[model samples]
Target: MNVYFHTFGCKANQYDTEVVRQAFADRGAVVVDDPARADLAVVNSCTVTHTSEAKLRTFVRRLARGGQGLETVVMGCAAALDDGTIVALPSVRAVVGGADPGAVLRAAGLPAEASLPFPLSATRSGGQGVRSRGWLKIQDGCDEHCTFCATTIARGANRSRPVAEIVAEARLLAAHHAELVLTGVHIGTYGRDRTSHDTRRTTLGELLEALVRAVPAVRFRLSSIEATEVDDPIARLLIEAPRHLAAHLHAPLQSGSDRVLHRMGRHWYTAATYRKRIEWLAERLPILGLGADLITGFPAETEADHRATVELVRALPFTYLHVFPFSVRPDAPAARLRDQLPPAPIRDRAAELRELGEAKATAYRAARRGARADGVVSGRQGGKVEVLTEDYLSVYLPTAGWDLRPRFEVTVD
Candidate 1:
């Protein structure tokens, strides 16, 4: 069968899609890039917000009418929402819910055997190697039941992978890509579950030490982690071994007002705590690529609340922001809560934060006017291929092929 995999959502979802695609390929299914040339089109989706869900529905609808007579299937978190509207759609052939890696094959009534491993050990594109960063989803699921979140319900509780297994996978991925991004829904909480079950368990800090040692050549970037998780051990990596660990830390600050944060079910850190932690990180890693996620309008979010949030943004040394207009997902406590802001003001507030983000990003990029940043070329553009810096800047060069070697340093100006 000719299959085209359509993936939507976060890096974790992207990693999951690659795993699923490889599984299908091992079973003699020809993976095609174009939907029009495929017999099956599987959408590995995300439904973090109502708009995201709408985008998926529209995308699925378009695929069904693509003139290829393709069978459509939904996988990952969107399907896990278990929304009747998604499954009842006449266009959908199958729906696979939750984080079961092999949920698609089971939904398709196909055999999922262990012998047929992913054809290539390295990350492959169109049956050949491509410039890409390897993603290691070392953990999944969330334990926090934030009032505005539906992800925890979809993904279940935290279950971390063993350190040895992670190292093994990183070694294999290092053969193809020079850099690997360690990702998870909640990576900071890495060995919490295992440590509870067994005393001799390793934390995220210990795992990082092992990974850097195991694969000396490969640089690792961390996905989003809670502000509270940025302990002394993690901060020490910037000063000790700058080459192994990237100088970037994506910590989320959902709200600046402690009241708003509490109402949102955020427990890890207060506004002051978040500020202190990032300040410490910045002091250690001066050019540290700092980023945060912000929600503009939430239930009962007054003008004072919004002002406090904006003021906090101004105070922080953030290089980029993932500003989300407060989106209320069904079954979330925030959705049921009173005083939901209208779409207009929410959009206006989001726009303000976004402008601030753009300015910060431009400033951050400008600061690296003549700095030398190193990493393997991770992607190819029209004429210039992209080489991601140690601090997570995507630098483009005028000339390069798809398969650029590791240690391809570029002067970012």
Candidate 2:
């Protein structure tokens, strides 16, 4: 059987797809690159935004139109919370909820006995084949209940993988890939679910310490984490071990207004607290790749609230930003809230925030010109191999005479 996999939203979803892909491959199914060549399609869906779900439906419908007798099995967050909508789509043979490889295998017509280990290792670096980097999922689910988010409702509470198991996967991935990205729904809350006697690896920082010690050859990058959870050990690694841990952090700042944040049920930190933590980190790392996710025009958000968010974004040395206009999900708490902002203001606020983000990114890129940095050969584009820098910059270099090492030192131009 030939299988093609499509993933929507987030690196965690990407990692989940990899797991399911490997499970099929282990059962002797050929993984195809295109949906047209496959007999079966596995789509890992996301419910982060209404748009994401819409895209998934559109993509699946397109696959059905290909007329190759392709049967799709929909899984992940969207599948978990779906109310007969996804399965109702044409060519969808089955729908398996949540990020479980075993459940996906069973849904794909395999018997219960055919399910492999939950977090199985890939034969190559990535899902498709050998690649420059791979995603290593350390945990799953979210414990926080942000009002604007349906992730908690879809994925459930935090459940962490064992330290030894994660280390084993990292070792295997490191053998084929130059870098490993630690991905999860809420990576900042890693190890919080463990009530075991050994507390040595109970934190993300400690987990990094273990990963670094186990696989020193491969560089590890965090997918996304909370600003407040940047503990001392993680900070120490970023400051001291640049080769082990990349100097980049994508901590989400959903809204900078305290009122807006409180309304969103983001009780972890206030705007002031977030600023202090990020500013401290920025000061320590001279060339940090700082990014954040900001939501514009949330329910009951005022003009003053938008201004506060803009001010906070300007005050920080952000390299890039993810500006999302609030989309109402029927299952989310924000959908039920009063005084939801209209479409016009939401679009306008997102545009302004995105413009600011572009300026910051352009400035950061220009500043790094002619500087030497550590990078990995990601892919080829227009005859030049794209070297993704440790600080999240892409520097294209000549493909000729490349050493083909796991990591490379390149001069940004």
User: How many backbone clashes does every candidate have?
Assistant: 0, 0
Candidate lDDT scores, in order, read: 0.81, 0.89
- The predictions' CA RMSDs to the true structure, in order, are 2.2, 1.6
Candidate 1 residues 1-413, lDDT tens each? 88888878888887888777777776788988788999888898887887889899889888888836788889888798866888876568888885454668766566865343433233555463454577888889989999998888888899898787788888888877777888889999998888654468778888898999899888888888888897667777766787888888889998889989999999888999999988877776767888898988888888888888888888888889999998889867799988899988888889989998899889988988788877567766578877788877887776545345656767887
Flag regions of model 1 displaced more than 4 Å: 113-129, 196-198, 400-403
Error of 1 at 293 (Å): 0.7
* Ten contiguous residues minimizing lDDT sum, candidate 1: 114-123
Instruction: Point to the candidate with the largest TM-score.
Output: 2
Which consecutive 10 residues in model 2 have the weakest lDDT in total?
Answer: 121-130
TM-score of 1: 0.94
In candidate 2, how many clashes are counted? 0
lDDT by residue for model 2 over 268-325, one digit each (tens)?
Answer: 9999999999999999998899999999999999999999999999999999999999
Backbone clash pairs for candidate 2 read: none
Q: Give me the candidate number with maximum lDDT.
A: 2
lDDT of 1 at 388: 82
For model 2, what is the error of residue 145's alpha carbon versus the real structure, in angstroms, after optimal superposition? Answer: 0.2
